[model samples]
Target: MEHRHLGHSGLMISEVTYGNWLTHGELVDGDRATACVRAALDAGITTFDTADVYAQGAAEELLGTALAGERRSALVIASKVCLPTGSGPNDRGLSRKHIVESCEASLRRLRTDYLDLYQAHRFDETTPLEETLIAFDDLVRQGKVLYLGVSEWTAPQIDAALTLVKDLGLRSRIVSNQPQYNMLWRVIEPEIVPLCLREGIGQLAFQPLAQGVLSGKYRPGQEPPAGSRATAGGRAPTFIGRVLGTPLLERVQDLVPLAADHGMSAAQLAIAWVLAQPGVSSVVAGATRPEQVTENAAAAGRPLDEAARKKVDEVLGDLVDRDPAKTAQMMAVKPAWRTA
Candidate 1:
């Protein structure tokens, strides 16, 4: 229910954003997806995030249907571009051609004429940064996208974009970043966080539960729970590799009593941990059920105190991924996004 400003901008977003990455119109039924979105709204979540590449665009359509009749002025809707939507070379990247076309398509799919925030899904090294920035500026000037953001971009990439915008006298600049951040994944901590803080960009974190690994449902030695993401067939399983071992599971188990002590679930604890980090504007949590949505929304605005955070650090000693080089990969672009 608590809202935070997206970076230094005037726009505000709910602390816990409802995101349908692999759930809506993909892993779950349409009814379930709608119910989860309703649950998020009932819990006072006004921010909804989806990507064009999620479920091949079905996710955006499902989210649009779910939020249909809600007050658009009272909500903050966000979507992303720069992903391969088809086989054509123009189907992806942050090029001017793709960005403009993708924004129009996203608006149609989201059932909204203007996006509260439009983000680059990932950096496109092949495309000239000027082309992408100009395209984003064009959208901003046309009143299609209110704010700009980038996901999975490194510190240098962000800095370079900001510098270019300043040098070229462009109006559009990055306000937020969407990165995979959670209890087990601290890859953005060392370099990206400092740079973003300095650059006035806030973190709209994704996978705050470590793709359900921190949900405490995945036992160390036991088989992944039936129908769980780890057991399901999709790209969600791909990111679950980092935390599937017994060592991490055992540490998670140790945190259970800690969660009980705090009167929260393991999932809530995971969410709280991410929100406590500096520069985090919101934690985008995914849900398959209505109850899960409500449960996660409760983690908003309530972060652990210094003592509790220190205890968590001791429990997860040396397990965090802090390497700056691991911030991004070439999944979206052939050779990674940062050209500098």
Candidate 2:
């Protein structure tokens, strides 16, 4: 329920944000999605994060329907652009054309005049950074966007964008950065976290439960439970399945007892761990049902004492300190490079 300043911006977001990544159109129907949004609002989650490509834009339409007639000023709505929406060459990326068109489309879908936070979903190396920044600045000047942010950007890319903002005296500032952070994926700590802290860019962490791995829903040597995301054949790709299988499940099993020792569910403990990190403005978690909203919000206030925090660090420390070399090599050959 606690609120935190969204970077250097005047906007303040709830410590726990409701994100519509996998659960919006994939797991929850229109009615269930509406109930989940209501649950999040009741639990004091004022920020709702989604993307243009999530469930191919069905998520935004569903959220728009859910928030109809509600007090718009009471909430912070964030959505991202980039990622291909079609087969056309200009269908995606941070080009000025796509950014502008996508923003208008998102506004129409969300039924909102302006977005509280408009983020670039990924770095578009092909698009000139100056062009992208100027486009975002134009959005701010036009009153269509309150602030600008980026998701899944490397530290250098963020620095470059900020530099461009300063050089051009752009109206928009890069106030927040969204990245995947969880017990299973602590890769951001080594460089991205420190850079955000130094630059005053708020960190909005997504996938805090590692796609439900940290929730202990998937056990080793057993099929994913019915109705679970992993159980759905087409939901997760082959590589994700391999990553979430036995080796990671073993780690989750080890951490579950640690979570219980602290009187919390694995989901809560995992989210608390992300919030404990420096520069984290909010942690975005998705929920299929109303009760999951309550559980996720509870992590905001659960005081992870020094002892518990250190214990989690000890358990996950080695896994967190990974060499980027292997990752780079994989990116070179992986067909799923776009997903990363």
Candidate 3:
């Protein structure tokens, strides 16, 4: 597996990180989760991404069990905070109390003493930026979290945090941003990429296949294939619904042959497209099956060349979402976690 530095930091992570978002505790059983993780390790994936909010923390526990006997020092274990994990008023957000407590809980769940990277699941509009930065700095000082990151944060929010970190001389600053970036979803390209590049923050892009839409499995007018996330009854993620449109699906079909021409699966082509973009440190791909993990891991270090990328752009012509405003807009629409 190819490795890349997380931003300008010395820490290197596998270019393809195995992440468990909706699959672990929520969608699949423990045995299946373990099998997928084993596939990732076998494929040379050294990075694992999970969150405190995924399946109300069961995901972290499952990941911990799966990697129990592995050499901890060789793995880049990452998790996130700032999401509602309980009903209590103090159970969520990036407040100092929540951050500290959450870090401790995550360590226990992951069966680790320190996190390779701890990230804000999302920007906390309710908490003071200084308080949040200070809390992260405290974790760094206490040796609980080695590096810091944020997910889905706007360019302005990141800039403000970095400025505060510098002015306050905090020990920890953001090294990465986790955002949904793929061929179909390019919202982070215009603003976040430029800003992060300038500030020395790399992007650990998630949903590199647009939740399987770019895999060419969902036909333009046909029902979503059986057993797919799109067919997961009511358990499907809301984000998957956005890419199932006829126009998008039809355009996705055009790229299937393009992928074959390059000796890649549609999924691999999609992942390679994201890696080709600037400021991307890794692509976090989740899977329910072992072969899925194996397929995704192969996408690393095999980026699309200039002509191949241009052909992809022509095939996807005007179907991509590049609006930087969508970042803040998405944050606004996300349900606010209860503070009371």
TM-scores for candidates 1 onward, in order: 0.95, 0.92, 0.95
**Higher-scoring candidate on lDDT, 1 or 2:** 1
lDDT of model 1 at position 149: 97
What is the C-alpha local distance difference test score of candidate 3? 0.89
lDDT of 2 by residue, 105-202 (tens): 99999999999999999889899999999999999999999988999888888889988889998877899999877765655677777788888899
Q: Which pairs, if any, clash in model 2? A: none
For model 1, what is the C-alpha lDDT against the true structure?
0.87
Residue runs of model 2 more than 4 Å from their true location after superposition: 233-242, 324-340
Model 2 earns a TM-score of 0.92
Which should have the higher TM-score, number 1 or number 2?
A: 1
Write the candidate numbers in order of decreasing lDDT.
3, 1, 2
**Cα misplacement distance, residue 126 of candidate 3 (Å):** 1.3
Clashes of each: 0, 0, 0
Off by over 4 Å in 3: 331-340
